[model samples]
Target: MSDREKLEARLVWERPEPASRPAPEPLSREQIVRAAIALADADGLAAVSLRKVGASLDAGPMRLYGYLSSKEELLELMVDAVYGEMASEGPLTGDWRRALSAMAQRTRRAAKRHAWFIDLLGGRPHLGPHVLAHVEATFAALSGAPGFEHIDSVMLAVGTVDAYVLGALRNEASKLERGMNQAEWEAVSGPYIQRMISTGRFPMLAQVVRDATHPSADVVFERGLDCVLDGIAARLGR
Candidate 1:
């Protein structure tokens, strides 16, 4: 089986039955949200249409309108739900660097697990309760870090990590498509690497890849975090 096949076998976004459970009481908004979450958790986010969510809930798409105003609203809710899973209260124990690193790692892991999430997340950034909760947790994690005086600095720090994680995933997803594992990325890109070298057309670009250690998602993310932290520490005189 191909890697995609294995991924399909493993991550289920849609429930097996794809129908909502019968409830003893009238379906509350909470029930609707829960059903949507289950549907997304079982199936990839791409499959979580309003109709699909309602079908999973054993209701028609129109029924979902009674609660959520539109499909966009529902998607936002789902994003928020995913955010709810992030670590809420563990960021500020003692070591600030450790805390920041922990938060970055956890976010990276979360992105990898919910692989389709980052695709839709940025498209809608109004931020539901759950998304806010996760951001709050992230801020809390960086609370005592240097240069967090204004909310802008904090937002910038969080955005930097978020961008780093998302960028890393883009590379990973591309590799997954091309069957280019770590070793393969280096081997396959070798020609592309060499072409620039011999051309001498772009010396700087050529040299970078010539000695260039082909970067991995982890390495890129860690380097980005280190740079950001270094800048923050510098500004704060830490």
Candidate 2:
């Protein structure tokens, strides 16, 4: 299909099931998506394909097209599946700040559980039912808050929070994917960094490297989240 045609194609969720009787083997969209997700989880998004997913289900790749029009549809289904996983963490509570903080934390935890999740994030707008529900819940968190009186304000606030959360998750996932955990990074580059700092050419860098008490990832994430919320509150005059 042409690009425009592909873009206008109906989503898997919107498409009607095959008009014919069910396949003798009883394959379903959920089964296809679940198998695709398993492949992604075990390896990465690159490892998931219509052929592989079909093989996992003991069917041919053509069988999957009966349910999903294209691989893009499968990806959309997979992304929505992960959103369903995120929603299972339960609803947000407390005031706007607390609600948003909880949302970010929950999202971070979800990304940690599914590293491939970060790969799909930010690529396209997901409008699946579960995705819409999560968006609705997020909007509900700021619905009647003081600074979110306008829809624009609510959109801005949510977008800002999403930006921070996605960036943080992507960074962490990238590090893990490269097999360079914090300890590995330090072990590999520590000597070179220390030598550069000892040259006294960059005082601020030297001071930060020498004096900063690097907190645990959890602590750092919480502090950064709080800082983002603080900025939002102050900027919005809440």
Candidate 3:
């Protein structure tokens, strides 16, 4: 397929109805996507495939082709499905800072639930319905902020929150993936780090490492988020 055709195919919503339809079966696109998500959650994104998902559903791999044409399409479907999980209960209440903070928290929770999600984020264009709803809600939150009267300003504010959340999640997810409990890591690396610091070549690094208190993951995330929000508030003079 040409690039345009591929892009069209990737968009599940834009696809035209099949000229002829097969008789309805017990399976559905939702089921297929859910099965794929389960596989990804249990293993990792790399473990998700047509064959594995089919096995999970007790159907042949060919059965999924009716719903998703390729692995890329499957991934897009999976991404949208997770975004669906992030749907907020109500609309933004015009408190831009609170709305942005809530949205960041929701995204972080979703990433924690679906660790594989962090890998797929920004991997491709997400024009899916759920993703668009998220974008719309964010814009609505920043719509009338003092310095964000322009759409560009609104988008910049939203992007700033996104960047901060994604960066924080990367560090959080890495710790989980390594299976290294904080105490265990400290025990293993503490002696080695102290020995290196004793060499006197890195006094500044040693001093900082010794003096700085290690905060819990939740504390670190909240502190970083507050700092970002403060910057945005300052920019908007709010």
Which one wins on TM-score? 2
lDDT of each: 0.65, 0.86, 0.84
Which regions in candidate 2 have their CA more than 4 angstroms from the true location? 1-9, 19-24
Give the top-scoring candidate (lDDT).
Answer: 2
* Candidate 2, position 138, lDDT: 93
Candidate 2 local lDDT, 185-234, one digit each (tens): 88998999889988989899888888999887788788888889899989
What lDDT does candidate 2 reach at residue 137? 95
Residues forming the 10-long window of minimal summed lDDT in candidate 2: 15-24
Model 1, runs deviating above 4 Å: 1-44, 88-91, 141-153, 174-196
Question: Cα RMSD to native, each candidate?
Answer: 10.7, 2.6, 2.6
Model 3 / residue 219 / CA error / Å: 1.0
- In terms of lDDT, the poorest run of 10 residues in model 1 is 10-19
Residues 100-177 of candidate 3 have per-residue lDDT tens digits of 988888888899899999888865568778889988988988887778889998989899999899889988888887
TM-score of each: 0.68, 0.91, 0.90
